[model samples]
Structure formats: C-alpha cells, structure tokens
Target: MPAQSANSTSPAADRPPAARDTDALLRAELGTAIRKLRKERGLTLVQLAERAALSHPFLSQLERGLTRPSMPSLHRIARALGTTQQVLMAAAAVPHPDIPVGSAHLVRSGEGLPVARPGGTARMLGAPAYSVHPVEYTGMSEEFQDYYDHPGDEFVYVMTGEVEIELQAAEGPRVHVLGPGDSICYPGGTPHRWRAVGDGSLVRLLTVQNATGEADRHHS
Candidate 1:
C-alpha cells in the first residue's frame, strides 16, 4: 500500500482556499451592492443597521464582506433596505437567467449567483416570473437545528453527501437520513429542518418552493 498523506481527507483540505476566496468574492460583491444601495438611499451604516435590527459591527462586517449572513438575516436586511430579497440576491456578480414572457431562460455553466449562508451557499435559479422558486444549496457537515414552516409546497433533491431531514409530525418529529440522489417532497406548511451528517462532508440539494403572489414563512 502507498504511504498515507497527512490529513489528506480532512474537511479543511477538502475546502480549498480558492473556493473559500470565491465565496468571499461573491460576498464582497454583495456587500458592494448593499453599500451602493445604502449610499444611494442616503442612509448611514448605523441607520441601516438599526433599521435592520442587526448590530453595527455585524453589519459592518457584512458590508466589508468579512462574514456571511444567513438567509433570514439577509431578509431582515432587505426589509430595512426597502427592497425584496430576490432583487438583492439577483444583483450579485453571478449571471442570472432571465425568464421572461414567452422566452427561454438560458444559464451558462458558472453563471449561477451564489449567496453564502450558514454551513452552506444557496444559488437562486428561479425568478419571480416563474411559477416556482428554486434554489440550490451546498452545505458542509456541521451541527445545526433550524426549524420552520411556511405556506405552500416544497421539494428537495440531494445531489451529494448525506443529510438528516427532520419533519415535525403530529406524533413528534420524523427523521429521514438521506444520501446522494435521494429526493423528498412535502408541504411547506409543515415544520422541518435538515442537518448535514459526518464531519467535513458536504451536502448539496436543490429546493423548489411554491411561487405564488407571496408565501408566508415563519422561522423558529
């Protein structure tokens, strides 16, 4: 047998600096957009942070692209910015597929806009003009227990790694551990959570949600 390399399979090794930098670059691009929008609206960082209910330091880091914000946090920020989350998410450096009336939407490889989140990065694939809201999430294995329920239906299909999906049932909570290629669909009204399994393992899945006039989402 060949000699084993030191920690070749470690999570840190798996996640190269280039990938991390790419994520950071996207965050930086997003931060620049937020800053430009904030300036255009004549709102100081303090004012905007207060309006978003986020601490100034946190907001500063976010504006500086020093950290990533979760989807909920971004939602709050978008509310403070007086803009929709989708609009802000669409302005990133990543190319967006334009799905117009009676038109074909084309998305070239590496054109998807990626929004970084806790333990994952989400890419918005569907537009407001579409009948469905689709986002692809890539997450690294970590300890997480976020739960929520919303209006409409949702579908999830795993593309890589493993995950444990927890769904709130009348009896209690049903758990389903899934591997690559597995899929699940259910109503968004049901409370649920998904957690990555195995240390350093990365999980990727596509989520499609109902895209009506508007959908109410309550997070816990």
Candidate 2:
C-alpha cells in the first residue's frame, strides 16, 4: 500500500470530541513552537525538512498545525533546530512568552517543565529561549545507551551519588567516573553517554547545553 501523508489523522476519528479537541490544541501549540524555533534560526521550511530528513510538505503541514509528528520525526526536527526534544515538548506546554533582554522567567520548586527520560526523571530548569539550556536529572538509565550527539556543548555536574560518563574520543572511547562535586564538559558534536554507577540508588545531575554552533547552521 502507498504511504499515507504525515498530515493524515484517521486515528483520531474514533476518539471522543473532547479528546480530539485536546489533541488538536496540543498539535497547534507544538506546531507554533516548532515554527518559532525554525524562524529564529533563520531556516526555511524546506531547509529544516532537509536537515531533519523529512518531506517539505509534511513539515509545512506540521508548522501550520494541520498535523503532528511522531516521536522519531520530532526528535529529528529537534536536532535540526539545534535543540533537544525535551525542550520542544516542554515549551509546547504553555504559550511562549516574549521577554526582553536581561529579563527572567521564574520556575518555583517542583514546577520545572517535565521532560521524558527512560528510567529517570528530567526537567527543564531554564527558559526555552535562554542561550544556555539547563536540565536537571534525578535518576539514571538501567543500562548503557547509545552515544548522543547534538549542536552545542554540554556540561554535566554530578550533585549526588556516583555517575559514569563515556565520551567517544579520536583515540578511542574514554570513560570517566564521578562522585559529588565532580563535573565534565565537552564540545558539541562529541558523541557521549552516561549512567548512574550503583544499583537502584538516587543520583542527581545538572546539565547545561549552549546554543548551536556556526557549523551546524550551514551544514545541519
């Protein structure tokens, strides 16, 4: 069978009216967030689609609030936008506020924007538009995971418990173990992964990632 357009929404047909409305609202909000990020980075619809390896028409539909992207597609778009999927998801939770330079957005205790992570709890600690995005993590993956690479630098500081961080170096893969008060910083585009050191224990980390690099803008 031929592939359906990404804008197709037959699955929502069987849902109750209220549920469909909620879904539509979410799609619209997410679409707006995507569009804003794309424009802020001076990218066109076709440019973003090419970077994300998606169809131009589909991306147009997504930005127009006519469709929602799947998780994989969303991840691709997030990477192409020089940001993380978690940031995009959290930003969509509320209207994007316009704050002047030197202004601040306050998030009270336990009110940080939630970010989904397997076997861990993550939340965005800074506003989406901030030059440096900060996310707090309270747990670790049950097992080692694939290396993750993105557009900007990432600095991780372990606040409690033991943590293991692996970085892919030109020589080979290098692993570092850290306890409280230890930190590591690496440039963007470096492949890296991390996990808690011990069995079923609490580990806390604060990660701050910078804005996209010049190379990412021209090539990705």
Top-lDDT candidate index: 2
Number of backbone collisions per candidate, in order?
0, 0
Candidate 2 collision pairs: none
Regions of model 2 farther than 4 Å from truth: 1-31, 35-74, 80-83, 86-102, 214-220
**lDDT value, residue 191 of candidate 1:** 83
Query: lDDT for every model?
Result: 0.64, 0.69
What range of 10 consecutive residues in model 1 has the weakest lDDT sum?
2-11
lDDT of candidate 1 over 120-158, digit per residue (tens): 667766543455567778875366545655554788898
Model 2 residue 23 lDDT score: 54
The collision pairs in model 1 are none
Q: How well does candidate 2 score on lDDT at residue 75?
A: 65
Residue 11 displacement (Å), model 2 = 18
TM-score of candidate 1 to 2 decimals? 0.60
TM-score against native, each model: 0.60, 0.63
